[model samples]
Target: MQEYSIAYAILAFIVLVLKNDIKDKFFFSLTFILITLAGLFSYEWKDNFTAWDIFSALGGSSTIALALLALLGYLDYIRQEEEVSIWLHVKDDKGNIIQKEDTNFSILRKNCTRQELQGILGVIADVPRYELASIKESEFMKDIDAIQIGKKKKIAIIVSQEKEAYQFNSIFNNKYKKIEKLKTQTSLRIDKDSLHDAKKILNEVGMNFSEEVNIFTKMIVTHKGLSFEVKIHNDEVNDLTDKLQNALKEVARQSKEENL
Candidate 1:
């Protein structure tokens, strides 16, 4: 049993080092506890083991215990910023807006009308007029819109049928050379009838779209005024700007690391 505990402790340390997810932390904690208890109850208690055996268990278990503490801190960091949102704006120095609200978001459901598009895009149309696409249902033209961000920088907004969001995303990728994609939560399922009601409400001012709409909005970013595609789990639209900035920085950091 003492040998088994030592082996388990060593294995757990290797796994914690290799895996980066939060779940791995839980795994390490469980294995650490089991090994600690096993060592306490096994032959080590009879004082039969050498100093080397005692040191091995203590060192390995202590490593895992410290890792467990770090993992808990990381989990709390994740919990602090849990909300679904759109990236309304991400700016760079020189006043060049890299990712702005108008250019960074698109929503697609089973059925979306022009009026609904107007309502969704209209919210941010005050200062500069939002360039709305004339509703088209042609075989080639999918429901999509464009919001200009800065000089030669634009974001595409697209709407698609259920499960077809990826297909639409592919279309965007093919058109843009370097694009980064960020995926947000799919809104609550919106039935066909509810979609119609949403169009009606969007046509009005005070009313808001119902939460039941099965909508998925992705932000496709341009790399260095070219394009780069990245996918991030969605959060609150209000808070997405910060997340987007973090993603952009991460990509840049990775590129730097790779070059080194």
Candidate 2:
């Protein structure tokens, strides 16, 4: 029964990962293999009284361990890490102090997702997706919001997309959609249409909601203002926006949601 509990938990995880995006056929199949193997061992089988003793029977913690490893692998494949900075900055139009920029950005860093990148930039730049917690402990990244949690509890991180690299800096200052979110270099073919859907998905997924910096793009085939919306947690939001957009593209076009 204990094995069954763990196995079911793993299966649930597979379902959750798959729910993010089924477009990655490779990921889909990998998930299937993991769930199948986990179920096979956890479920009763004739002459397969393997139980939790899989480690001993397999001459080591190979089979069940492999199953767990497989689960981890799937998680690594689907789980997206977003880069955010817990920064200290100027306040609102009313001209009031925003906060310490230290404590304000600090708590948010600790609670929400955090990651490591090749480097940090005030604006757009290529950062290989490398998320890690230990990097948070570094003295160098002291001001960066390594974690974030709670209400009105917010974070401020620059999205590395060249188009909207100035998001954090321009949140209040930059005119909405004025800057061109360059299309060619954003590291992905992001569009305005899909980003809206991603916000709905994040809200549905229960992420703490916050504002986003706009990414400017080159004039599209329609010359439709050349820009896109990138919510907070630049990578995760953009990734979700892409997936949601792609999925919706496959979903037949729909009306635009103004506040993506």
Which structure among the candidates has the greatest TM-score?
2
lDDT of 1 by residue, 119-163 (tens): 655663332344422234342133222111111122234332221
Q: Which regions of candidate 2 deviate over 4 angstroms?
A: 6-61, 80-171, 174-260
Which ranges of candidate 1 are over 4 A from the true structure? 1-28, 31-47, 50-60, 75-158, 161-260
TM-score of 1: 0.21
RMSD in Å for candidate 1, one decimal? Answer: 28.1
